[model samples]
Target: MGNAAHEEVIASINSQISETNALINAALVAGTPTDKLRKKLATLHGDLKTAQEFEAAGIADEQAKDEAFVLGAGTEIAASTIAAVNAELEALGVVCRIEQGGDRFAEVAHRIAVALRIHEKVREKIGEAAAAVERLETRINECAARRATITAARLDGKSSDREVNEFVALAADIDALNGLLYDARAKLDGIDDSAEKAAVERLRADMQQLVSATLIEAVTVHVAQAEIALLDGIRKLHRTGLKHAPHRGSTPRSHYLMNADLDFFCRTGALR
Candidate 1:
């Protein structure tokens, strides 16, 4: 399907899934008959499978592009200029880190340049992390819908053999999706500098303190630290791929809470 059509189908299916989940929730609370709920759930599963297939297809293309971009970015950064990094940051809505001093201007610029180099180097990992999170979200939503269907069936108190079988299947699906979501989140959290603002504040404080005592020395040290921090961010991106970082876990049942941020990166030219 063309991109527009694909998006439209996805939107329609998602709306249906939402409505189905709501129906399942109400049916469960009201103790609807297992057979009746099972029929509805069967339809929901069919739609969900279609949606999953579309997502799978899109992921194939996206992954290919991601691989190419990452490799190319690595090469580009090796010889990248400050202007290139500034352009990239501007595209990402990040302010360029340029120094406004006399003698330390070049040093500060070099530091920012290197940091952006690291940023470019890890760009693909960021894209992959975003994609993984999207996949996890879709799976989790589908599982939740399935879980609601199973719950509705159980509420009937006379679930048939088929319903029982489906319940077991849903259990396994939810378990697998939960694991995927956990891994996806760990990747994101590992690379996330959610504490970046605080870190910057500390650095600013230090720079101010050293302005009088040891101007050039403090600026050099701070620039080095900035480069090191950016390098560490890149290291974490690779380590996330190794799956060695601590798994702090995904968000709550409100999975869409993170999708907005992910969508921003995916939809914007950030991935470019």
Candidate 2:
């Protein structure tokens, strides 16, 4: 990219990061509740804000400095959230990687990341969710085992009534932990999906930097389909003979023609 393009992209990211950071600070102050996080998220990005203010151009003076600061803070906050979430996930993933049965879940999570081109850090966090569930389940099992042991000992009346009650209470604790674990696991299932959405948002930001417009079009062409047109052009030239194909002309013209062909070929996925 040219220096201008680079600057544009960097500025856009910085603007968003700053705004996100601001909201993060606000959230930290208010406490990171789900509702507050959702509210912070619905705010517009820098590009969107700028475009929205397009009508202000005719004013005596229009300053974007204040707006920039808010956007920049928010961007930073969002980025930090992504990083923390990912780190938690990564730790969980490594912890639960021992068994092949657990690995299937990891694989499924990984597939979601790949399908969405999610940032690697976020994917790591998504993987950790399952690990957390596994840990919770382990805790529940431990409580159950302890309670069972105590109950069996009670068959001989070796334990006190208070001790039996405590064991029974632990069983209840296990049930509560299971409830939390199941809910956590369900939330984790969507983390990767949000990561996918984040990737798309990243792309949208990039497009805005390139061309500040919200209307987007995705252009994709299979190699076979794209090549068909080129092949058809060549076939037409072959059938029309040398006269219709045009002459090579002078040395300068020939060099220019060859270079253009090379450039087009490179862009058409031939080299790739």
Candidate 3:
């Protein structure tokens, strides 16, 4: 569903939850003997909180997918550019391996430094790609708003001076939006992939290292999903009123999580 539709449903659900909670509170105040209903409502509240956590987790998981895409794409661009330079060095029989014995270490380090420099260009290109996406997204949103306004004016059917002016503005906006869309598409299509693919064919240890680190970042996709599930469970228990509140446990487990994880990593240089 679209965001507006989802929001409408969420608002309705929230209203129901508030009404239920108020009813339970009123029953308690009036001595109406609604213990069973109170318990049921408590369970429903737990489930609602769980659903909210799931919703949050789902958003994080989706964002992880975007992050992985950007990092993976940027790494490929950097690796390929680095590989192209390495291939030329190989053709000239200049060994650039850091561990390959004598004086070559300096040259090898220099070459690696040069490859790292290419990463700066890679970063710039990545920034440009993000900016292009933002521009397209902004323009599309503006176009949608203008179209909605124009549609609303037409539906009114009065054809007043205000409506005529709105129609004129909408026409101008549509023209600008069309041009912006074309520019965004052209920028995306102009990205070269053949060079990146060629770099994969002639991969180096450094490129492998880069790819490995990028893959580690991609691992967050799964981590994000897992975190969502974990939070849902925690929220479920916490929302279950007095009976199942997580902190109510007599012997709460000492396993490090959240801020504890930060402390552990900072102190021990290890992640739990």
Most lDDT-accurate candidate: 1
Q: State each candidate's clash count.
A: 0, 22, 0
lDDT score of residue 82 within candidate 2: 39
Superposed Cα deviation of residue 193, candidate 3 (Å): 5.8
The TM-scores of all predictions, comma-separated, are 0.30, 0.30, 0.33
lDDT of 1 by residue, 83-194 (tens): 4434554564544333333333334333334444445545646677889999888887887787787788779876678877887887888888888889888887788543
Candidate 2 lDDT, 14-95, residue by residue in tens = 5775777787778779877556544554553545456434434422122343344434543443444334434544563422
Error of 3 at 87 (Å): 30
Candidate 1: the clashing residue pairs are none
Give the range of the ten consecutive residues with the poorest summed lDDT in model 3. 97-106
Give Cα distance to truth, residue 249, candidate 2, Å.
28
The sequence of per-residue lDDT tens digits that candidate 3 reaches over residues 177-254 is 778778877776676545644443444465456445434444555467677987676555445633554455533222
> What is the TM-score of candidate 2?
0.30
The worst-scoring run of ten residues by lDDT in candidate 2 lies at 211-220
Off by over 4 Å in 1: 1-111, 153-160, 192-272
Cα RMSD (angstroms) for every candidate in the order listed: 30.8, 23.5, 31.0
The deviation in Å at residue 176 for candidate 1 is 2.2
